[model samples]
Target: MAAAPRWRERLFALYFLSHIPITLLIDLQPLLPAGLQPPALTELLQWYAASFRDPLMLQPPEWFKTFVYCEAFLQLPFFPVAFYAFLKGGCKWIRTPAIIYSTHVATTLLPILAHILCHDFSKAELGGPRTQRERLLLLSVYLPYLLIPLLLLFTMLCNPHYSHTEKRKRK
Candidate 1:
């Protein structure tokens, strides 16, 4: 019998499952056509942007859009695979892919976090968070995307099941 999933594996499974809808609905909205986008979901995205003072979502720059595209094309596909693997537990096949996914996501978030912290939002007509408080609030929203992936990367890298393989012995 396979080992039951640990708490962290279950948590990661939940993360992957939750990410699927978020990607399809909110994260991929900027790339989607108005006709293709659902009205209620679009409203939810708009509400999140306004509430968070997220200029990146409100008026996405080319670079930010590129990131969203990657999320749609790449990470979106991986979510289901990861969800299955993590939920099943001890499937070594997931390790490399999980490592790659975590690294890519964590790398993408660094620049985004920096922009939130350092960008001169006031200069833009459609500005982002202008005050420190607003910026912090926005940062809080983006931070989990960074922190969780980093945690996954660390786990994948350090865990023996993920990092080591057993060799088959022949007579």
Candidate 2:
């Protein structure tokens, strides 16, 4: 029945604060007009999409494109909600969003990992990560997608008030 520790609350607030810009710049920015975007932001997007001869930057597979679209549409909206929930420490409202985001990340990452592990590199259409360093560098971007959602889910599960009914049970 005790509230989560001060450090935990602070951690969540910081995590959520970091998520806001990622949602805006990475998830939501491309949907807006260029004139409406800052020149620096536009350049960042260009570099994000086209830099380093990245497979995602280059011609990606149909499945990867589909995942990108799905993530943009479905996952983008949750960023604000998750941000708010984490900012507030713990709330019943966090439960559904946490579950949805967690499931989404799990579903999205599993197949990508599978493809990476199973695919024959020489025949890849987009010329996927070639060297060990390149593969690790590419994964640096993706591993957070997997870790963040799981950590959010764990935090929600640990929250004393993750269910509103718990508030009454404590009285």
Superposed model 1: Cα runs more than 4 Å off? 1-5, 168-171
Q: In candidate 2, what are the lDDT values of residues 1-171, reduced to their tens digit? A: 666565755665676667667766665554555578788886786676544325553455667767767767776666667667667764666687777778777788887766654555666665666666666666677677777667667766766656445425554
**Model 1: which ten-residue window has the lowest total lDDT?**
1-10
Candidate 2: clashing residue pairs, number: 0
Residues 6-119 of candidate 1: C-alpha lDDT, one tens digit per residue: 987998999999999888878988997776887898889888988998979868999999899999999999999999999988888888899899999998999999999999
What C-alpha lDDT values do all the predictions have? 0.88, 0.65
Clashes of each: 0, 0
- The 10-residue segment of model 2 with minimum total lDDT is 49-58
Assess candidate 2 and give its lDDT: 0.65
Q: What's the TM for model 1?
A: 0.92
